[model samples]
Target: MAKFKIDINANKHFTGELSPVFSVAEARKASQFHKGLQGYEPTPLRDLSSLAEMMGVKGILVKDESYRFGLNAFKMLGGVYAIARLLCEEFGWGIEQFDFDKLKNEVDEKMTFATTTDGNHGRGVAWAAEQLGQNAIVYMPKGAAEQRVKNIRSHGAECIVTDMNYDDTVRMVAEKAQQNDWKIVQDTAWEGYTDIPTWIMQGYSTMAVEAIEQIAEQGLPKPTHVVLQAGVGAMAAGVLGYLAEELGASDLKAIIVEPDQADCIYRSGSSEKGEMINVGGDMATIAVGLACGEPNPLSWDVLRNCSSHFVSVEDKVPALGMRVLGNPLAGDERIVSGESGAIGTGLLAAVHFSDNKAELMQSLNLNEDSVVLLLSTEGETDPVNYRDVVWQGKYSSI
Candidate 1:
């Protein structure tokens, strides 16, 4: 039998009916309302000319989100924006009154926020709550990393470990919020609670908006292929919305990558419906951000229309990504990365392999003239994985 886990699959799944709900102009307006958000930061898009040349591309760039609000991950953008929007929408205040820094400094400590996470999103929600001088309760699965649990606790949030996985944790958190009237802010969407998650997705549009501006300034052509790793599709929705509004569907070919174990989008494309799968075991890839099942319905709608393709990357790709990018940058230059944050570049490598290059390139249909963009959504948050991938160079060893 073919090594199913090692084999790469080329699957093109698209839904012809879904339409864009938010435009770039609308996203821009939301971004303006978030002008002084505490965790907002201008992430850098660094040129990888040398790496691009090595991969036979004209240009390759990495949108480094390592320094986003000093949180070391892009999850904060969505979480913070979602929470801020929820607060504003709930309180009927203008953006000026919801100014995060000002509100954070003055808000009563009696307030509370709640969210469910595999790790990063909960940490982000907890961090945002702490910064805003509010109480936070973070729910996680039973097997969540000690580091993430500790990180949430460090931010003064109560970390409740449930006897379930990430998806179950989400349900538990929702139930708790319903019973207790806690402010539940999640980046993923469900029925009746799409607004906050949509706002969170809108917050992620800042990355795409920034990418377009940075490409213009760097003298690089527009990206021909933009690959993103997704869990619930919030991040991908943000980028797709930007591309649909600014570049149009024909200008940019987009792909959503996920681990073979948690390929909800891949399966959704194949089946033409949203499906939920149980998540458990051996999710050792550092790119843990995308390890989610049960696609976000709104995001699923957008990705179905806007994204051109979906690919399932192996767990090993993340290890390789960390080894490749983390070695020279982290070991020699002191650059650090979290496992879940580095998978964008890993997707880039998987899509550019020599054996599959012919079909992959044909699917994407680009030559040396093509420009590519990858989002590095976080720096190393787990010190142990950081040291192993960066200093030890243990990607293949895994």
Candidate 2:
């Protein structure tokens, strides 16, 4: 079991901001990368009018990622892209050279790739490893739910359970990287090793770009507000980066949400520095993804400066949002979202903190027309917990 320590001093070194929004050239590159990715498609951007009415909102849009690459989550784009990019860089091989069959044939079962994840990210890395025929060693915090762990191992990755929380598992992976000749491809960046993580963030831009096109095709209002739930903030950073670059002066506000107990981004924004807060105990929910003690070193600066607001929501919000999306009112959509995945919709309901309800209705202008966008970033990564909360009304208390 790995021990997680709050490194007050280490957090200080992460005080720099994100790179500017993608340049036209960079945007084009990201788009091309998105296009090159195999079996990748934009998840639907659907309106959940019934839920919106229940929340006293004019309109609610859900960017459902449950269908992303048949992986049931958005993490696959980042982790798999990072691995593909790293492999290409090391071998001087074009990414196009990586046919699934060829990559699968190359594995000798001797080399291992290491990453630390709470849930979706690990499943993503494991899925990538299985596709590429590489062995993967995943380090996860001890309290990770069985369903999430099973998902990772089911992808043929070896899972290591640690005694600490998500932050410590990161350190555990770092140590493993040093002791073993394993390639470390992680979504969150640390000092000096920021490139691959940055690539992972860039890969996430594909989703945002897809969302823009999808919204346009649907003839809906442009997204006025984007609610992102952060762990280390990489996912939020990725989406925001693309939106800033492609969406063009759309009066978009990026609202960030985190667990009340694990509110590192909120505190970091308030503290005006990259901050670390030790979670009091085991995580209270199996959103399993957003329970982090600190924001990623590379992402905190970007999140603090670029995001419109950082709000902390109770864990129950996600469970409620998940139920709402799956409810009969939502129709046959089958939006199998998990806790963290529902945070965006949770923020939509808790509009006082968001301060966007008026803007949502376009009441300030009396247009009575506006659009709100929420990202359902994962599917039911923890089906047991999902069933317990949504069906049985019995959620595990932390």
Summed backbone clashes in each candidate are 8, 0
Clashing pairs in 2: none
Candidate 2 regions exceeding 4 Å error are 1-18, 21-31, 53-58, 96-110, 272-281, 328-334, 352-369, 395-398
Compared with the true structure, what per-residue lDDT tens digits does model 2 show for residues 258-290? Answer: 777787776776564435444545655556788
Which pairs clash in model 1? 286-339, 286-340, 287-339, 287-340, 288-340, 337-380, 338-379, 338-380
Candidate 1, 10-120: lDDT as tens digits: 334444332445577757766665556644567888777776776678877778877777777777777777777777766687644576666666555456788888777
Q: Give TM per candidate.
A: 0.88, 0.84
The TM-score measured for candidate 2 stands at 0.84
Off by over 4 Å in 1: 1-20, 38-40, 101-109, 272-286, 328-335, 351-354, 393-398
